[model samples]
Target chain A: AQSVTQPDIHITVSEGASLELRCNYSYGATPYLFWYVQSPGQGLQLLLKYFSGDTLVQGIKGFEAEFKRSQSSFNLRKPSVHWSDAAEYFCARIDSGYSTLTFGKGTMLLVSP
Target chain B: DVKVTQSSRYLVKRTGEKVFLECVQDMDHENMFWYRQDPGLGLRLIYFSYDVKMKEKGDIPEGYSVSREKKERFSLILESASTNQTSMYLCASSGGQAYSNQPQHFGDGTRLSIL
Candidate 1:
């Protein structure tokens, strides 16, 4: 079975600082990867996705993620994170056979002024 | 934009009572899914339907049943509500192709409490 792992449980970063959230997946083959953000009391919104093309995929809200096949990892990065970027981040991979998504435990991001 | 609407934002029901949570999508998607979210645990799939009257069990299907009489609407039913079932329920929809790599659209979610 495919699984996603997010190592950090909570991360606090100062505003305007660079941000990177780690994600690792265990799968036999290259699977579609995605990043999603969820604000308090709201549903999750897609940040970005990696299908096949370039390893580096850009997403909404000035965010981007790079897929590294060798490490079996896809990490999300932002040059400068705003206060509004504080939320719970989740990394997911598409189930090869079922077309469903398997998500990570999630990392809570806190922006400090 | 794809719109997935869950009927209630919050619901309170008594233990052992029958509970129903409704979801509807406007994108005419062929795949609809139900998941539960809890602290320290990410979303866990409860059930999913690819077509009307076609339902598949997800990772956690115990004490839960689903109904998909219409293509756009999917309902999750709790046979007998329990406090352990108190959690946030989310609904999602995806494209028609079963194996296609389409992203799923999510709703605001319904917070259900069984007391």
Candidate 2:
């Protein structure tokens, strides 16, 4: 079974600092990776996705993720963190089949001023 | 923009009561999915429909059933609401097959509280 792992349970970064959210996947074949963000009391929103392309994938709100095959990781990054960027993040992976995705436990990002 | 709407933003029901959560999408997407969001569980898929009248079980379908009588509406039913079923329920839709991998658009979600 394909699985996604997000190592961090919680991360606190000061405003204006750079941010990186790590995601790892366990799969035998090609994998479709995605990052989603959820604000409190709201549904999950897609931040970015990596299907097949240049390893570096850009997403909304000044975020980008790089797919590294050697490391078995797809890490999300932002050059600078804003207070509004604080939210819970989830990493997901899907292999060609039923189209259902498996999600990680999620990492909570807390931005402080 | 894809428009996915849920029947309620928040619901409170007594335990053992039957609960129905409705979701509607205006995009006419062939694929509709229902997921439950818990504190640490992230989003667990409950059920999904690929086409009208077609349904499939997801990772966590034990307490739920689904209905897709119309192309735009998909409903999730809880045979008997339990306290453990109290969580945020999300609905998402995306095109099927040729557009299978498209990012799913989501609704605001319904927060259910089973007493």
Candidate 3:
């Protein structure tokens, strides 16, 4: 079975500070990984995804994620945090044969000045 | 840009009422999915359709049913709405088999409140 685990339930960062949200997965193969963000009362928006290739993947809104094979982790990172970046982030992987996604509980990013 | 539209932004219904939440995608994608969002649970898939008239169960499909009579539209039904069923429902679409790599595009979501 494939599952995602985001250890951090919430994280607070100051503006211009670097941010990192950890996501570790349990999978046998190279599963498709994705990062999605959801604002309060809003829908989720795709940040980035890694199917294969370079471990470091760039996404919209200055967000990037690095997939580490040995670590079994795909942690989302942003070099410079902004107030508008505060939202719930979900890490998901497409592992099941049906191409369905298994998501983590999510990490709430709270940006503080 | 791919567009996914949900029929309502907010809804309120009484328990035992049969509720329908509609979603339509104009991108002509072959895969459509419905999910319910709850705090701390992330997103749980309810049902998904690969093509018209074809459906498959997702992670959480016990209290939900689906209809896909047309290619561009999918509907989620709550057989007997319960307070526990109240949640933020999301609809997503992606290109079929050959294009399965495409990311799923989502709608604004419908926040349903059951009384």
* DockQ for each numbered candidate: 0.72, 0.57, 0.51
- State each model's CA lDDT, in order: 0.93, 0.91, 0.92
On a 0 to 1 TM-score scale, where does candidate 1 land against the true structure? 0.98
Taken in order, the candidates have interface RMSDs of 1.2, 2.2, 2.6
Q: Model 2: per-residue lDDT, tens digit, B1-115?
A: 8899999999999999999999999998999999998887788999988899999999899979999999999999999999999999999998866226767888999999999
Residue-wise lDDT of candidate 3 within A58-86, one digit each (tens)? Answer: 99999999999999999999999999999
Worst 10 residues of 1 chain B by lDDT: B95-104
True contacts kept of each: 0.60, 0.51, 0.40
TM-score of each: 0.98, 0.97, 0.97
Candidate 1: count the clashes: 0
Clashes in model 2: which pairs?
A: none
B1-115 per-residue lDDT for model 3 (tens digits): 8899999999999999999999999999999999999887889999998889999999899999999999999999999999999999999998867226567889999999999
Which should have the higher TM-score, number 1 or number 3? 1
Cα lDDT tens digits, model 1, A1-113, are 77999999999999999999999999657598999999998888989999899999999999999999999999999999999999999999995566788999999999999
lDDT of 2: 0.91
Sort by lDDT, best first. Answer: 1, 3, 2
Which tens-of-lDDT digit does each residue in B21-45 have in candidate 1? 9999999999999999999989999
